[model samples]
Target: MTRLGYQIPNFTYPGIAADQLFDTVVAQAREADASGFDTVLVMDHFYQLPILGTPDEPMIEAYTLLSALAQHTSKVRLSALVTGNTYRNPTLLAKTVTALDIVSGGRGQLGIGAGWYELEHDSLGYEFGTFTDRFEKLEEALQIILGMLDGKRPSLDGRRYKVSDALNVPAPLSKIPVMIGGGGEKKTLRMVAQYADESNLICAVEDIGRKLDALAAHCEALGRDRSEITVSLQTSACVAPTHDEAVADFEAYLQRNPAAEVRRAGTVVGDPDEVAARFADLLATGVDGVTVNAPANGHVPGRVGLLGQTLAPLIG
Candidate 1:
């Protein structure tokens, strides 16, 4: 069955305080759990944009917030939308997941991707290598994570990372799901075919078919069943009592960020039934799940709640 998840906006909102944002997220998560949402995801970014509030705006750490979420909600999986590979060592990253899984009673999924924000890396003093180099590092990190999870003391010699006989004690209680993000037709899709248990893409109605076709081809090349990989899409959403009201809100959101055309695509805007039909169409494309990116702050909490409570039943 297809599942629905939420991507909590950790950035500040126009008139809301930082603490208020976090509280609202926790409240929404609780509501989602009660409303039968499958997972709650947080983005892995250090700074926020103007639409997301401000770059220097108050932001919370992804894993830290997730740890708190582990305590606050039950029956919902928790993860970062996609953790940047450059942010932490593979072994350390594995340990973090292991701990989160333990704390959340085996409801942790690690969503990781090749780092893209070069500005964050530069500001944080992380070595920002070429894109190809970053992919190489990500590939190595995947190997290390999988190896350690399999009870093997892994040793790796790679261009970006070199590790020898690394051990992760207290192995995860369950085989944590490994979700790889990005829809790059080449290396990223190849990696997903070879290793990832789940794969996520930014939803573009026109491009999704082609991307799915590419992923199927990659799976064929690796002799893997395409059915084994759970396909997911990340898209924005806004719901209200009527289509006009929701579309108006969505248009207002678009007005705030004219440059992010992609973000505006595949956005489900309407009443519960309309949103459910939109999501059902996406599910028909072999998408096993979706992560809905709600507007930052509590401005749209009721909309999110309505989606979880109303659309979820129809789609599920």
Candidate 2:
């Protein structure tokens, strides 16, 4: 199981020229690789997320970044935190993930979701449909993608999508973990029970128990053991040497991005020891692990290292 994951969502670091941006990203990725993080993740969005920055902020292509990071980091699994199902053709996504797995020596996971972010869709000309429409498309996409990942040519002429014996060549060198990210009870959890190898639960800590209960019910209804799927929280950890310092770090983050707190996903903020205590509470809720983005200063040199060091032992 991947007990710890380091997510890099903020690419706009102050004072880092555009030409040197990826170098900074690579540096932090190497830090995560050397630290105890088992995975390195990036958001799959064409624009900067509202909670992170303005639309014009520097946001790179997810798969491109992952393929490049694979050369720099050996230990951490590479992936988009959650690939928007609406972003690409299902067969193309399957092929892309396969190539990433081979390039990374089989260290990759496919984290996908029912696409959100209406702005991205409306701006980029991707269909911005209702929630139901997106989920339905996601279900069909999954049906097509899973077969391809399994080395089977899948053809589907379904209500929402159609594929004609779509071929995926050069099968994955190793099993690529499939992680679905979201906390929708009826549709998302049901799909997770049926399809996913991992579930990255997205909810505040206070609500984790309820979400877990919902997921368990879905699993039971589907005749799948709850333990069969590895579960991790999509969360944030803001840590420093002291609680005050942690508070200051979060303030710094807010200054950097004034729209919203990405940490709202589920946050544990404090000194390392205090962070450990909060981590214990999150784990006690039955989640197998956590995927964390320290948006506060995560782009700063050595900042991700501090987070990994603070968290590794608790997860280890």
Best by lDDT: 2
- What's the lDDT for candidate 2? 0.87
lDDT values of the candidates?
A: 0.80, 0.87
Please provide, for model 1 over 170-251, each residue's C-alpha lDDT reduced to its tens digit, 9 standing for 90 to 100. 8888888888999999989899999898888874667888889999999999999999988888877787878888878777
- Give the residue spans of candidate 1 off by over 4 A: 49-53, 244-262, 296-299, 314-316
Going through the candidates in order, what is the number of backbone clashes in each? 0, 0
Q: Write the per-residue lDDT of candidate 2 for residues 136-250, one digit (tens) a residue.
A: 9999999999999998889999888899988888999888889999999889989999999888988767788888899899999989999889889988878877799888978
TM-score of each: 0.91, 0.95
Deviation (Å) of 263 in candidate 2: 4.5
